[model samples]
Target: MGRSFKIALAQIQPALGDLERNLSLHEKLCEEAIAEGADLLVFPELSLTGYFLKDLVPSVALTPESPALTPLKELSRRIAMTIGFIEEAPGHFFHNAALFLEGGEVRHLHRKVYLPTYGIFDEQRYLAEGDRVRAFETSFGRMAILLCEDMWHPSAAYIAAVDGAEFFLVPSASPGRGTPQKGIFANAKAWELINRAYAQLFTVYIIYANRIGYEDGACFWGGSEVIGPSGECLAKAEYLHDSLLLAVIDSSEIRRARTMNPMLRDEKLDLTLRELQKIQERRS
Candidate 1:
C-alpha cells in the first residue's frame, strides 16, 4: 500500500504583533495550498504572532477562547492545517503550541518540549516547556510534531518514533543574516542534514517548515524540505524571502527503511535515561 499523500509547507514572513494580518495571510496561503492538491499544510512557529514580541507577549497571546481559533476551524475543513502560536492557559503559564486542525476542528495540540534560551533565543523567559508528546492518526498516516528547538533534540524525535508516528512535522522560525543567499542557504543545508539523519535513523518521514524575513533585529531563513524515510530529499523550497515546499509521501517507505536499518528496535530507553542522568551529574 504505497498510497501517496501530498503536504504543502508554508514559508511565511509573518508580521510581528499583528495577529489579524498574520492569521489572514495563513488562511490565504492555506487556500492556495489546497488548490494545488495538498492534503495538509504546515506553517512556521508563532506565525499567528511574531516569535519575539518582547514585553508585548501578554497582549498578543491568544487563548482558545479568544475567537481567533473560530476561523481556523473553518479553514481546516478544506485542508488539514498545522500552525504554531502562543497558548495561554489557566495557570498564567504560556506554551509554544502547534494546533493540528482537521475537519473544521482542532484534533490535538502538541506543545514544544525543548525551549531554547541561548544566543538570540529568550524563549525560556516567555514560555514553559511542554512534557507531552502525542502521535495523531489522520487520513494520510500517523504523524507527530517537533516545534523549533525540539528538532535539535534526538530524544524528542526518539519519543515520537517510539509512539509509532510515521512522520514528524516541524514548524520553525529561525533568525537570518544580512546576506540573503549565504545566510538562508547555509541554515537550510545544516537543517537538511539534521532532519535527514533523524528521518533515516528512525525510519520516518520528516516534513519541515521554516519562516523567512526580519523580526526584532533577527532575520529568519526559509528553505523548507521534505525528507523521506530513507533520507531522500523528496521536495524542497528555494531559499527566498517566502516560498512553499510541497511533497507527496508514500507510507510504505517507513516499513521499507525499517527493514533495511532498524535503529528504533535496537534502542534501550532505560539505559539511555541512565546515561542522560550521568551526563547531568557530571555537569553538576
Candidate 2:
C-alpha cells in the first residue's frame, strides 16, 4: 500500500528542425496524459528538435530561455513531465538531456550519459555525454532518467539502483536499424529485452518511450514498452505506430518480487568490483 502510479509514454513523430511545431505537439500530448490521470508523461530522446537532426544541431541550438520550451513549462503545471532535447550550456558542448518539470517550473535535468557514436546514431558528434549516474527524487518516488543508448549499458541502471531509485525512465529515438527481412528481434526488440532484464534484476519499474516515423533514411520502430518489477512486459505499443502507451506501476510489486526472488539482497558488490578491475587490468 505504499504507492502506485500511472505513467504515459508519448511516442510521437516529430518534424526535424521545427521547434515551434514540435513544442505545440508536446503540449497537446501533455494535456492528454494529464487528462488520462497519468502521474508521469514520458517523451522520446531529442524530442524537442526531432531525431535525424544531425545537420540541424548547430543551426537550431537553443539556450534555456529559448521560446520553444516556454510552453512546455506552462503545460507542466498539471502533471510531471520528462522531455529530451539538446542543452546549450556553457562552452560549445551541447548535452542530450531530459528536463523534468513539476508544478510548472523545471525541477531537474538529467543528461544522457552514453552517447551512441556507432552506426547511424551520430549522437557523439553533436552531444557531449554526461559522465555520472545518480537517482533523483520526484513527486512520485525516487526515480532515475536515462536517454537512448544509456539504457543499453548496465551502469546507468546499476548506479541508480545502488543509489536507491525505485523507478527508471528511458527516453529514446531508437529506430529499426535493419532491413525488414530481419524482423521481430531487431534493435528495438533488443532494447525492450534489455530494459526488461534491468527492471527485473533491480526490481524497478522501467519505462521506455521511443519515437516513430521515418527521419531521412532512418525508421523509428515506435514500439515503446513498459516493464514491471517482475520482468513482465506490462504494455508495449505497436511498432512504427505513433501512440500513447500507458502502464500502471504498483510499488508493491517491488517488494513482492524481491521477497520472492531475494536477488537484490544477495548482490556482492565488492567481489563484482574485483572482477571488473581484473577486466580493466586485462584491457590495459
Candidate 3:
C-alpha cells in the first residue's frame, strides 16, 4: 500500500502584532486538525503576526527558540505543522520565515527569499531576504516551504524540485485585487493558475495556505487550496472566511505523473547552470 498523507490548511485571519492571540488561534486549529486525523497542518504567512505590519514588525518578531513557540512545538508531537512568523535573527535582523515542526522539534526553516516591494508591499524594507531555497526531509516525503512572494519566482520552485522535493507548502498573505467575477476574485484565479502550473511542471504536490480578513485596509481573500501532482484541485477553502481545508494526498501520484511526463527526469541542470554563470559574467 502506498503512503496517503492528510494535510490541513488553517485559513484563519491573524490578529495584527498580537502573537499571543494568534498563537491561541493556531493551537485551536491544531487541536481541530488532530481531531480530524490530519498528518500535517499548514498556516498562512505571518500567521502569528497579521500582514501589513509596517513598524509593528519589531514588536512581534520572535526567535526560533522563543518560549512562545513551546505550545505549538509540543502539539507538533502529535501532528506535523508549518507555521509562519517574523524571525528575529542575530544582530536584530528580522526575516519572514516559516518553520516546519515535527516530532516536537523544528525540522526545517525557510525564510522568504523574494520580498515584494511594489504597490502595497514593503516587505523588503522591514524584513531581510533569505539566501537559499532548500527541500527538507519529512515523514511523508521531502518537502519545501515557500513564504508568500517566494512562490512567484519560478526559479525557487525549480530549485526545490531539483533538490528532490515532492511537496511544496506555500504560506501566503495575499491581498485581494482586481475584479470579482463568477464569485472568484481575479487574484485568487491567478494564484490558482500559478500553483497548478508549478505542480504540473514539477510533478509535485502544492499546498497553498492563504489568510483572510482586513489588515491595514488591505483585504486578504482566503482561497487556500491543495493541488495534486497531476494539476488537480484536491481541496479549496472558501473566499473571505476562515476555513480548515483538508485533503488526502496519494504519494504514488507523483511517481505516476513522472512516469507519464518525464519532464523533471530529462531536465539538464548542467546546461542551465553554465548558461546562468555566463549571464552573471556578462552582467558583471
**Residue by residue across 16-86, what tens digits does model 1's lDDT show?**
88999998999899889988999899999888997887676777777765698888888889899898888
Clash totals for all candidate models: 2, 0, 0
RMSD of 1: 2.4
Model 2, residue 198: C-alpha shift (Å): 1.2
Model 3, range 119-156, lDDT digits (tens) per residue?
77899899898999999999999999988788889999
Q: Clashing pairs in model 1?
A: 175-219, 176-219
The alpha-carbon lDDT assigned to residue 23 of candidate 1 equals 89
Q: What lDDT score goes with residue 278 in model 1?
A: 100
lDDT for model 3: 0.94
Task: Give all TM-scores, in the order shown.
Answer: 0.91, 0.92, 0.98
Candidate with maximal TM-score? 3
TM-score attained by model 2: 0.92
TM-score, cand. 1 vs. native: 0.91
The collision pairs in model 3 are: none
94 in model 1: Cα distance from truth in Å?
Answer: 1.4
